[model samples]
Structures are given as structure tokens and as C-alpha cells.
Target: MKNVLRIIGAILGIVLAVYLVYQLRTIFVYIILAVVLSLLGRPLMNLLGKIRIKNFRLPNSLSALIVLIVMILFVVGIFSLFVPLIAQQARIVSSIEANEVARAFAEPLNRFSQFLADYELTEERFDEHYFRAQIRDILKFGKVSSVFQSIFGVLGNLFIAIFSVLFMGFFFLRDGMLLQRILETLVPDAEVPHVRVILDNTKRLLTRYCFGLVIQVALVTLIISVSLKFFLGIENALIIGFMAGLLNLIPYLGPVMGAILGVIIVMLTNLDLNFYSELLPKSGWILVIFACMQLFDNMITQPVLFANVVNAHPLEIFIVISVAGTLYGITGMIIAIPSYTVLRIIAKELFSQYKVVSSLTRNL
Candidate 1:
């Protein structure tokens, strides 16, 4: 009877939790953005606070304002420089004749068709009609539309996120410590110390992660842009590199996508060059730059900068990304590691205080 009651209670609790989550999703998004932005800006805010005292002249608020202005200027400068160039390149790509791409792929496709023809298939059936039609049908019938809808749904959420970050940054910079005290107040006396420890650890880890990401993005963008410019004379090196760096935020698959796009840009622009000899090598340089950047990020930048923050093993990280992607698409994938880290912190803190749960899950 007791076991039956417990199961019933668990089911009810889960249902209630799901309902509450659905109801509060909008509000929760704002809170999440606030937390993420605080993590991003805290280090700079703290540094400015310290330097004010050291200088004995400027106020901390003044220093912080200066930092904000400089950050805004740098972001705006990059956007203004790259946006127009990328737009122009995109127009060029769109203006190219579809026949050009078809011509490029025709020879390999012809050979492929011949290989299939030996098995009683023809080029029309294999390459032009059925195969492509089947691919389109599969996409139309399968999960592609849903995935695209979810992607656009996430894009729509960006406004809420931006507003939340701005709202949160104001209070986070001004009264973040006070907010921590208030959170501590919500916990029971016995759990307050554990909660505090968890919060402290999370703050430190997330701050380090954000800082490391910034450095990594900057370094990779510079490397890609410079290498492409020097080696290929690519006119839109900065834009291509910037796009690559931004996409690198998506993790493992990002570099591959970036490299493909970079190659396409080179191919479209260099109409005069030998397709395989000169164009391929120029495209190959993008891949080389990507490799070098990944090497530095994985070895030096990540270890030196984000050592303590992202403590999970590669397999654990991979599982988290895969699961998150499966559940909620790119937004989920982008945030998977951080979400896992936060959950781990909370679980560790709780389990440390409760021996019963710890003992039951000894393997974990």
C-alpha cells in the first residue's frame, strides 16, 4: 500500500511540475538570459571596480561606463565593416547561374549515374528525377519542416533574451551581491551553506567559460582572416572569418559548415582560376586555418582559459550535446554544456548533504 501510494504521488508530482514549467516558460527565459549576461559581464565589472580604487581618481561607475562604451564601439565597428561586404558577396552568389553549379557537378554525377546504370538504372532516374525527388519527398514528409519551425521559434525568442539580458545586466552590475544574499535567504538554515557554495562555484565556472569563449572567438577570427587574406587574396576574408567564428559557438559541426561556405565564396569569386589546382588549394587554406584554430582552442585556449569551468569529459560533453539537440534543436545544443554544468553543481551540493541518495547511486 505504501509503495502504491508513493508511485501515485510521484506521478502526480511530475504532472504538476510539467504543467508549472509550461506556464512559466516565458518568465523563465528572461531569468536565464539575465543569469547568462551577468556571467558574461561580471569579470569586466569587477576589474573596473578594482582599477578605480587603484587609480584613486576615477569612480568605479565611470570605469564601468567606459568599458561598456568601448565594448559597444568594438561590436558596432565589426558589424559595420563586415555586414555590407557579406551582403555584397551573398548577392554575387545568388546572381550566379544555376548552370554553373550544375556544370561543376555534372562530371562526377555522370560517373555516378554510369555506375548505377550498370545495375539497370539510368541518369534520369538516378540523378535528375527519382533520387532528387525522393530526397525532397523525404524532407517534406519527415522532420525537416518541424526542425525549421523550431529554429525560427528560437530566433523569435531572441528579442525576449536581449531584453532580459539588458534588464538583468543593470541590476547585476549594480546589486548582484545583494541578489545572492536574497537567494540565500530563501534556503533553510542547514542548506544555506551548501547552496552558497554551489552558487559560488557556478558563478566562477560560468564566468570563466564566457571569458574563454570571447578570447577563442577573437583569436580564431583573426587567424582565419589573416591566413585567407595572405594566402588567397580573398576580398571578403574578414566577413568569412567572422561568420566562421560566430558559427564556432555551435560547437563540433560549426567548423565544417564554415569551411564549406568559405570554399563556396572562393569558388564563386575566382571565376578565372583553375578549378582544381588554384581554386581547390585556396579553398584548402580555409580548412588549414580551421584546423590550426581548432588546435589552439582545444589545447591552449580552452585549457588555460576554461580549465575549471568545463570540467566534463569529451564523452560526457558529447552525450549532453546530442541529447539536448535531440530534444530542443540548436538553442538547446548551444546551451547544453552550461545547463549540464549547473545541474551537476546542484546535484553535487545536494548529494553531499544527503548520504542516503549518495549511497544508493555509488556508481554514478
Candidate 2:
């Protein structure tokens, strides 16, 4: 009868899990952002606690406040330096016709046309009209005007994200113990220790993942900004470099997107691309920025993870990112690593409970 009850409970749990995932999809983004923010803030919160900065050993809310202020100032500083340049570039781009710009900048397309003509390729089979229409459609769909609108839309999302993070971080930092105790009250006394272990593992993994990424991202941004100033000039460097660095947080798609932005900025500005004509086709300068970021992330970021945090397999990490991007696009990509860390902890626990699997994974 005990075994029968356990079987029934297991089946019920599976059904409940599927239902919960379907229902919780929308709220998942908010929960993830909150979790990431709280994790990033935890180390500073701990430092404050250790320093006895609170009133008579009581918790201080000021640590979270200070972190928030620093983050805002950092963002503001970057914006102040670059927004005007980007705006001027935008005006220049807006004043140009597509055909005129293409004449001025579409050398790649001209080369392709030359290749096709030289090869005596069947123009009819290529359906140049159809291709042109498709190109026009894509251009319309992804126009600079639409991109500017999307940027403004993201500003609203940024505010919502910030508000949610602060609200969640404050409570997590101040009253997380109380919340855990409440959760503990709901669990069976005998199983509470096991549950506590799970929660602690989750907290530690998330904290390391978030805090490490924050430092990593900040370092990458600083490196790109400095490199851009040295190589590209400060006229449009800060904003472009910062945007690229921030997007680099998204993984595979980021560097390419950033390079495109760099190219667009170069096209819009009065900078003398002719001087670097030899280096232009190779995109050596943009490549340098990406190479530096990749080097820093691999040499600096991954080594720190290996030294301190759990060492996830590269293939496992890739699959997690692919799955995450498929499900939630950019946001999913950002959250995928920490989410995998949480899953890895759970998987280890479940595997350890089964003798056969334990033997198989023990060597891992």
C-alpha cells in the first residue's frame, strides 16, 4: 500500500509540473530577472553584514540602495557620453535615401553583381525582381525607424526590470531567512534538512553565477569602451562599445550584432574610412574589439568559474543555451547558465538516490 501510494503520487507530480510550466511561462521572466538581481546583490549584502554596518547588528537596507545608485550612475555616465553622437548619426542616416546609401556603401552587393555577370549566371533563374522585393521587404520590416522605436520600448522594459529587481532584492536581502523559515514550516520535519540542502545549493549557485557575470560584463564593457576610444575615436565610441558589450552578454548572436552596429555608425559618421581602406574589408578593428572580449571572457571569466564555481561541461552548456534561446530568445540566453546550474544540482541529487545511476555518474 505504501508503494502504491508512492507510485500514484509520482504520476500526479508529473502532471502538476507540466501544468505549472504552462501556466507560469509569462511570470517566469519576472521571476528570473528578480532571481538574477538578488543573486548579484547578495555578496555586497553579505559584506555589509560582516562589517556590522547595520544598527546594533540589525540588517541595513542601505547596501541595496547603494548598489542601485552605483548602477544608475554607471548607466547615466555611459549614456551621457554617447547618446548625442548616436542621435546625430541617426539624423544623418534618416536624411539619406536607400538607393543613395546603397550607391555609396553597397560595394559587397556590387561585387556580387559582378561575379554573377562574369559567370553568365541566368538572371531569370535568379529572379532579380523577386530578390529585390524581398530585400525591400526586409529593409522595411527592420528599418532604422523601427529600431529606434524598439529602443524606446526597451527603455520602458528596463524600468520595469529595475523596479522588479530592486523590490525583489530588498526583500531577499532583508528577509530571506524569514522566508526560508516559512517554507521550512511547510515541509515535513524529517525532510526539512534535505530541502534545506537543496535551497542552499540553489542560493550559492545562483549567487556565484549572477555576481560573476556582473563583474564579467562590467569588465567587458570597460575593455570595449577603452579599446574603441583608442582605435575608433571617442566621437561615437562609448555608446557603440557599451551597447556592443552589453549585447555580448547574450552569447553567439551578440558579437555579430555589435559589429553590424559598428559598421552602421561608421557609415553614418564623417570618419575617414578611406584611410583604413586596406583594413576596412577585413573589418580588423571590429574584430579586434570582439577578440578582446572573447579573450577576457575565456581567460578571465571561465578560469574564475573553474577555480570557484561548478565546472559544467562545454557541450552541456551549449545545449542549455540553444534550448534557452529557442524558448525565450535573448532573455532565455542570459538566464540559461544559472538555470542549468540549478538543474545540475537537482539532477545530481536525483541521480545519487539511484544506485545504478550513482555508479554511472560517480566518475563524472
- Which residue pairs does candidate 1 place in steric collision? none
What is the model-wide C-alpha lDDT for candidate 2?
0.66
- Give Cα-based local distance difference scores for all models: 0.72, 0.66
TM-score per candidate = 0.75, 0.77
Candidate 2: residue pairs that collide: none
**What's the CA RMSD of model 2 in angstroms?**
4.5
Backbone clashes (count) for model 2 = 0
lDDT of candidate 2 over 79-175, digit per residue (tens): 7876786677678766655554444445545566668877988463233444455456656855857987999999998888777766776666565
List candidate 2 segments past 4 Å from native.
1-15, 50-85, 95-100, 106-108, 117-158, 231-235, 270-282, 355-364
